[model samples]
Target: MKHNALAIALTLLLSALLGLALWWDYRRNATPHPTPGPASFPIDTRSAARPAPAPTQALPHNGLYRCDGPAGTSYQSHPCTPGSRQGDVSGGTLSTVTVPPPRPLPPPVASVETPTPKVGLIARGPRPGEGNEALCAMHERDIKRIDEAARRGQSSESQEWLREQRRWHKDEMWRLACGR
Candidate 1:
């Protein structure tokens, strides 16, 4: 009987300890918490409600204008009228104006000189009617001789004859012979 009573006492102590542990765990997890819902923040509404300021206007259109003032002269849209006296506020000086008159250009001078003709040596073989039959025949014979000399590698003789032939067949000679 003593053994059975000791067993019952042990069982009751274990049950009480388990119940205390459960109660402590429940209390630790039960503190008041924030509700699980959506959150919001404040926003500034003045920037959205106010409209933007207007842009500045451009200067007036008059004509080409130039300014000469005491505070570093510069160009501007509206120039002061001629003979108008204006005082500079910053420099404290009165402005003086001078109007320029439109001058007439001199009449284009008429030319009296005649243009001279350009003259140069001709390079082609022989101009038509450059010489009388005998002279032309002589020229043809000289050219043939020069060609024969060139073929034989006598370049100096060929070149000399070519110069002579060119001189003989000048434009004036051709014109005279051709009656042009």
Candidate 2:
């Protein structure tokens, strides 16, 4: 029982020491970062020098394609015949002749959706004399509205207008209610 306890204690100590050693090694080898100066705000590391690709003389499918015959090579759109020196070999690329890919059938067109009419819920603030309401209560109501508007991401203009309204009301409340 004593040996088992001692073994566990030793194992824990070894693990802690191993972690400490790894941390110390990392700290010792780490390169220090210098404080960025005003000039270092914008760093341009892009290499501006790169050679342009060599132009391919082969025009893609201007009714001309590479045709390889059993005897010799010829340029034609059709397959090679025994009497004629014209046959198309698929797969390998020829520099002088360009083969266009087979035309794909177009997808079916989608129908346009009819616009759904918007039903706006009218919001009317308290009357002028109701300004004696609790300061936090008014702000809480405004905050709820702003939070809901922001969550929905429906109307940024509405949020701005609410903010403006709040600002104007705050100024008025300060003057009249607070007697500032």
lDDT of 1 by residue, 9-42 (tens): 9999999999999999999899867776668567
lDDT of 2 by residue, 1-180 (tens): 999999999999999999999999999889676765555546444643654333334435545655444556677754334454333345566466469999999998999966655457544554554555677467557767656665665567877886787677567566554422
In model 2, pairs of residues that clash are 80-86, 80-87
Q: Which stretches of candidate 1 lie over 4 Å from their true place?
A: 1-99, 108-141, 150-180
lDDT of 2 at 64: 61
Q: Which run of 10 residues does model 2 get worst, by summed lDDT?
A: 50-59
